[model samples]
Target: MYRSHTCGELRISHIGNTVTLAGWVQTVRKFGSITFVDLRDRYGITQLLFGEELNKQLDENPLGREFVVQATGKVNERSSKNANIPTGDIELLVESFSILNKSAVPPFTIQDDTDGGDDLRMKYRFLDLRRNAVKKNLELRYAVNRSARNYLHENNFMDIETPFLIKSTPEGARDFVVPSRMNPGQFYALPQSPQTFKQLLMVSGYDRYYQIVKCFRDEDLRADRQPEFTQIDCEMCFVEQEDILNMFEGLIKRIFKDVKGIDYTEAVERMTWEEAMWQYGNDKPDIRFGMKLCNLKFPAHTFPAKESLSSLIAGDFAVFNDAETVIAIAVPGCAEYTRKQTDELTEWVKRPQIGMKGLVFIKCNADGTYKSSVDKFYSEEKLKAIADAAGAKAGDLVLILAGTEERTRKATSELRLEMGKRLGLRKADEFKLLWVLDFPLFEFALEDQDGGGAGRWVARHHPFTSPKPAHIETMINNSPKVADLDKYLEHPYAGIKANAYDMVLNGNEIGGGSIRIFQRELQEKMFAALGMDAEEQQHKFGFLLGAFEYGAPPHGGIAFGFDRLCSILGGSESIRDFIAFPKNNSGRDVMLDAPSEIAEKQFDELSIKLNLK
Candidate 1:
């Protein structure tokens, strides 16, 4: 055997016990006659001392860093214990040793604080994984996985395997296609989620199903995103939205208790999608702090007897008054912003695709006076009214954005986050719970190949979503005139509401799922509403629709982002830290060099051609 006990198993009680241990050499310190070697493995590390006789052997056959070895030694109480490590209280007195394997000099030092850049570490990932910090991350990942499995098993959830090679559906993100060798010219796309299979499992009488599986998506990558990722996916039969939410909420609490020993027993807050966007400017709002945007309308004293909104709208500032919608925010205790700071805020809105023209600011002085870009356009009375409208107290600064209504609202929201960062209000560890409800059923993003120009309409969320029963009549009968630019008006399918819920944490959407349309007719109607032809529906979700015919139970479930959960738990900004082998920003596997040209023979067998652009 390579070892009798793990490196972590030895303690003071194991003194005088003859032990056989095996691990890679962590460090070697030689003191002429006596030599000390730190033997390390996944479990832990142990210090091994070689006496003078063995030291002479070591001179000829010297050990190097990361060299694998096996040793038989007598455990003894350490003469000088290290308080930092668990196995520090004991040491091994080596009697004999053998080199199991030798390692080439690693490109980078295998230290916790190794001086290696991201690209270098990724290229030599094997060596990088040997670092204590990297090993600890992997260990934490295992602990999380084990904890989730245990929780699911205890809750009577069955672990069912789903096919990785599955049919592709053209709905959301692009797919990673795999060419079929036997069936030439045909392809199989990877499972985005086990979405349809889990639903089918419900129909096949599996009351509960869960899989900690890999999901693929071909989309733009971010620090927290990857081309391939893992999820704690699950589905439950005969359950409502409340049932799924309560059950998964418990799962999260259990993970916290088991993994980090933190108890999140309190009920998580909920917010509608509409409210979340209106108040925080994003679907996944970071509720950790408050710098909420407040609406203020009307210009100054000389205009009308209306309340003044000089901070946002002014006679001279045509940007705000000219726009149909203008939004503003108040930043507390930052009334003394310098010209450089204000210029920076203006430049921020000019980033490509964000599409905001500029920003307006009003700094309310301590003595109730205000300094603003639109100050000349309004009197003192007008300034006070505008300040009051914005809920801006003395010593507070009010910021404003103006453009097209949608763009202005979006810009105002971005400004809140930016100012939050500058004010140190967006704390990661401090979680703020909220429930955003009451979302619109449909959103138009041009027609899906039906080609109706601005008159086209589609589901805001998805066609499977159930419309609010009260608004059903309005949605079905009314084809009212709606603006093309601001497409928030009533349409043929505007009243639907998916039985969906998203759990957001620390400004990141960690989980989202919806109660599916179980009825075949309803499903078909949904497809028809989305402009899918009968043939298209049959080709895409025909199997799913057929499964519903076999007495399928009403089911719903949510998938938790295992990586994002761990990232939040570990207090890291990027989820890649939790993922063992994550790809870089460009979706390239630095270690493996994937997405490369396949061998010509292999491509020919699959009847594939690489039309590289």
Candidate 2:
């Protein structure tokens, strides 16, 4: 055997025991004739001592950092014990040693806080994974995976594998296609999610099904996004929205307890989509801190029954007057901001991404006086009314953004998150979960596919989602066509809600699902509403529609972004850290140099031509 015990196994209890150990050299130090070396493996590290005689051997055949070696030694108690490591109290006094393998110096030091940049580390990811921090992330990911499997198995959910290659039916994001050599001029698109297959399984009488599956989408990349990612996908039949909420809620809470040792026993908070937009300006609201958006002016159609506080900011101010909406958030304890600091905030809102003309602020001083940029247009009483409308307290700063309804609401949400981060309110250790329900069943996107002058109605979730029972009648009765372009929101279809729900944790959408349309008539109507004609729907989703005609039961399911979950649990912003051999931001495998060109012969076999634009 190369070793009797791991490099990290010998302890004070094993003192005087002769053992063989093998590992990579971590660090080497010399004290006159005596030499010390730290040996590391996957488990942990242990220090080794080379006496005067053995030091001579090391001097002749020196063991460098990351050199694989084996050593036979007596476990002796250390003269000076290190309180940090587990085996610090014992040192292996080496009698003999052999070099197993030698390594060229790594491009980066394999330390928790390495000196290498991102590209260098990615290029040497195998070396990077040896670092303690990265190892911990992978360990956490495995724990979460094991925890999820245990929870689902206990709940009678079967792990079912699905096909990776499927017909390309464009739903939201673009699909990554694989050319078929067997059939020229044909291709297969990767499964974005096992949506149709899971539904089919339910129709075929598999009540509970799941897969820790890989999903792909050809989309823009960012810190949280990856082209190919994993999901904890699940589906269940003969269930309502309530059943899905309870089942998947249990999964997440169990992951928290099993992986993070967090109890999370409290009930998760719930809100409607309208209420979320009205209160926080976003569906995924981080409830760790309460800096809810105050809608001073907004369109009635957007928040149909929501109370309007537009009268509070009604004045001679043209910015507020001309704006489609006015929104504000009262950031606590920022009333003492200097003019320069406030101007900096103004410029921040004016950035191209934010696309705001300017920012308006109201500083509620501790002495109960109000100071505002728009004070010229409004009196002290008027300014106080606006502050009161925004729920501002003494020593609070109210930041306002005004423009089009969509832009203003989105900008306000961004500002709220930014402020929360600045104030250290978005803590990594703390977790809060919420369920936002009753999303608009369909959204009107500006797609001129039919040469329609304005836009068209697309399914907000997917074509398979069922409309809310009350809203189904209106959907079937009214035409999806808009009579007036400016008044699209006035259509009855815009008022319809889906039987869908999204689970949000700490301002990130972790999972979502909807009760599916099982009846052929309703499913066809949904397809039609998405502008798919009979022939087109038949070509893309005829199989699914046909399956619905065969006594399909009511079903719903949820898919949690497994990578995002691991990253969140590991207190990381980027999912790549939790993933092994992950592609870089441009979706290129730097280590393997993938997504490269294939041989011309291979392309000819597939009968494809590269027409670079």
Candidate 3:
């Protein structure tokens, strides 16, 4: 019962109304004996005036920053109004007040524009939460949750609770294990996602299910990734891929409308995985710009004349001749690039991760002149012909990368980003959504393949995905061929498309899911194709297999990265800004200093050994 009305709820209409309000001291302005203290709370701020009458009390008990106080005052209109704040036109004429709580001096300023670094802010997160920017972010996160929940509830989806400490099965990421003290030497893993449980819910005849749940992944972190994150997980039974897609699309549209007030009327564009890779050199392509890499050495097309080759491809450029794939990128209107600029581009490709041997360039000059790194190899006619083939006009530059397939693709992606920066194409506010579908059913990891990939076909998506109808016969036909040493599994796994789809937003994969195989025989086939023997399958996923036996419905769903989605909606690149308490790059909770070792007694009870290297 600190106050009747909130600081933000007062306005000119409440003038002459006696009220009591309490908040932390934001700022204090003094001119001679008259004093004004800005009292702040989560709602807003109000200026409290202490006249000569209360001057002795105010002077004796000085008001410092962040001191929580209770003040009973009469609300009055301000003589000089502030146009900036909502309560600008009003001030409180204090009748009486008392200090409730005092705070020690904070480590950093609690203003919206405080010049505090990430580490400092994270360490003093309690103080940081008082900043207006952080407050707004937290409020926006709440709004997102509300909008999502409202939408789901209105659409007949239940907000179900899933267990966190569940049995561990390997997904793509590493599990965070929790030791069970009650059961010695046994452990329970924090769920990466409620994948199995949600599927079980579908078997229990819950047609639509959703959860705003925490998921854990003990993996290396990136700018967009965290060790622990939240997902707006959802699943629906007896629905096709189209139904799931449309439902989620509606949810996204509703969120945008409710939170951002922007109408995304256009239907989300769809592109096959092959098309995305071929056109943008990435499955999650940023479609805002178009400097698409064109394959120059495609065997389908006839070789261009020597005039085209003379630029770089013409003569004895052994790199291009020896390359399995030759790729080129067009830089619009950069034909007059200096030697230093050209060298910078060359150095960019030679980064350790990209691993390109070198970058070759053909600068198409005005007046029909040309300059190139490989000018020695190509004659003028060949250079012009090559420029023509690249569709490079005068004042354009064509960069070519020639190397092994892997190196060339990586280099091409990096080069695209560079050109994107130059062209001012990667705008943060502008969003481009694309659906990338038709991913391969299996991938050949070299180490896993060394084990003869026996029974072990790695999921290109996941083992739950249903193979495309056209590839079912092919998969069955080749299943046993690999078992026989005399024969080979000649059926290309790359061509086998899974019933999978990924939603990409501005080059980040926002969400992905696939139509799951419901039939037990199909599930067994999928496991066997991944090289899982009957015993191994039963041991790892015996519960799921048993659940399928009790009349499971065909189900599929997608989980949106709620943090990342909110970050994008809040106009920030990093998800850390949207999350309330985020960990550092190395996954340390700076505030709590988590992951500290426990006492020996606790470890003994759990039967865990701490073997520090």
Candidate 4:
């Protein structure tokens, strides 16, 4: 046998026991007559001692870093134990050794704090994985996966495989297509998520089905996103929104306990989509801190019930009065901020990402005084009123942003998160879970249709999502057309809400799902609302619509972003590190050098030609 024990297996209890160990050389040190080497494997590292005689052998063989070696030795207690490692208490006193293989010097040091850039590390990812830091992330990822599977299996959810090569129905994001060689001219698109098949499984009488599946989307990449990613996809039959919520909440909590040892005893909080947007300016708000947005002035459509503060800023302040929205948040203990600090904040919002023209501020002084940038537009009393409306206390600074409704709200959200970061409020160790419900069933899609004549309605989630029970009639009866662009808010479809919910954790959307339309008529209507004609719907989703005609049950399910969830649990901001062989930000596999061109003969056999633009 190459080895009797792993590098990590020996301990003080095994002292004086002769054992064979095999691993890669991690570090080598010489102490005059004696030599020490650290042997590493996937399990752990163990120290090995080379006596004067064996030291001569090591010198002749000349062991280097990452050299694969096998050694037979007696386990002995270490003179200076390394408390940090599991195998610290004991080490191997080598009697004989063999160089199993030699290795070239790696491009980067195989250490946790390696001196390598991202591209360099990615190119040498195999060497990078040898680092303890990266190994721990993968280990944690596996633990989470195992925990989720165990929980789901206990809940009677069957693991079923789904097809990767399926029809291309371009709905939400672009699909990555694979050209078919067998059926020459046609192509197969990868499954974005197994949305249709899982529902079909429910219709086929499988009460509970789950899959730790790979999903693909041809979209822009971000820190949390990849062209191909995994999901903890699940579907259940005869379930309402409440049942799915409870079931998945249990799944997440069980994962927390098994992986992080966090009990998470507190009940997850819930808020309506409107409430989340109104209070925090974001659907996925970080509830660990409390800097809720205050709507000073906003459009009627945004917060239909709340009164606007037009009267308070109804002076020569054109920036506030003319803007479609004005919003603010109170930054505690920043009332004495210098002009330079405030200027820096102003520039922060003015960036193209935030897309705001300028920022306004109101300082609520400790001595019952008020100061503001718009002092010429309002008096001390009006400034105090504005600060009071924003929930600013004494010795607090109120920061405000005003512009178009969408831009202003988004900018305010980014600003709030930035301030939260600056104040050290968004802690990685602290996790807060929330559910944002009652999203709009349809979002105005002026940019989606050709010619941009008048915006057509598009499904906020998907065409399969059922509308809220009360709004079902409104959705069915009203034509999803806007006669006037200015009065689109008056359309009945604008008021309809979906039976959907998104689970947000620490300002990131981890999972979302909605009760599906079981009836063929409602499904067809949903397709029609999304601007799909009868023929187009028949071409794209005929299989699903046909299945619905038989005996589709009331099914609802959610898919957790498996990578994002794992990263969050591992206290990491990027999912790439948690993923093995992940593509870079440009969706290029640096190690494999994938997404490359095919041979001309292969392309011709597939009846394809590349037309580079």
Q: Tell me how many clashing residue pairs each candidate has.
A: 13, 0, 14, 0
* CA RMSD (A), model 1: 4.1
TM-score of 4: 0.97
Which ten residues in a row are the worst by lDDT in model 3?
299-308
User: Stretches of candidate 1 above 4 Å error?
Assistant: 297-312, 336-356, 433-435, 447-455, 459-463, 468-488
Write model 3 residue lDDT over 410-472, tens digit each, in one string: 689778877887778888777777889888887654454434444345888777888877877
RMSD of each: 4.1, 1.7, 3.6, 1.5
User: Per-residue lDDT of 101-181 in model 1, one digit per residue for the tens?
Assistant: 999877888888898988999878878888888787777788889999999999999999999999987546788999999
| Shift of residue 254 alpha carbon in model 3, Å | 1.4
Work out candidate 3's RMSD over C-alphas.
Answer: 3.6
Q: On residues 1-613, what C-alpha lDDT tens digit does candidate 2 reach at each position?
A: 9999997677788989999999999999999999999999988898989999999998998989999989898999888999998888999999999999999998888888799999999988899999989999999999999999999999999999999989998678889999999999999999899999999999999999999999999988998898999999999999999899999899999999999999999999999998898888888888899889988887765666567787788778999999888999999999999999999999988898988999999999999999999889888888888888889999999999998988899899999999999999999999999999999998886555334334789878888899998999998998888878678988898899999999999999989899999999998888888878899989999999999889899999989999999998889999999998899999999988988988999989999999999
For candidate 4, give the lDDT.
Answer: 0.91
Q: Which regions in candidate 2 have their CA more than 4 angstroms from the true location?
A: 447-454
RMSD of 2: 1.7
lDDT (CA) for every model shown? 0.79, 0.91, 0.83, 0.91
Off by over 4 Å in 4: 301-305, 449-454
lDDT of 2 at 529: 83
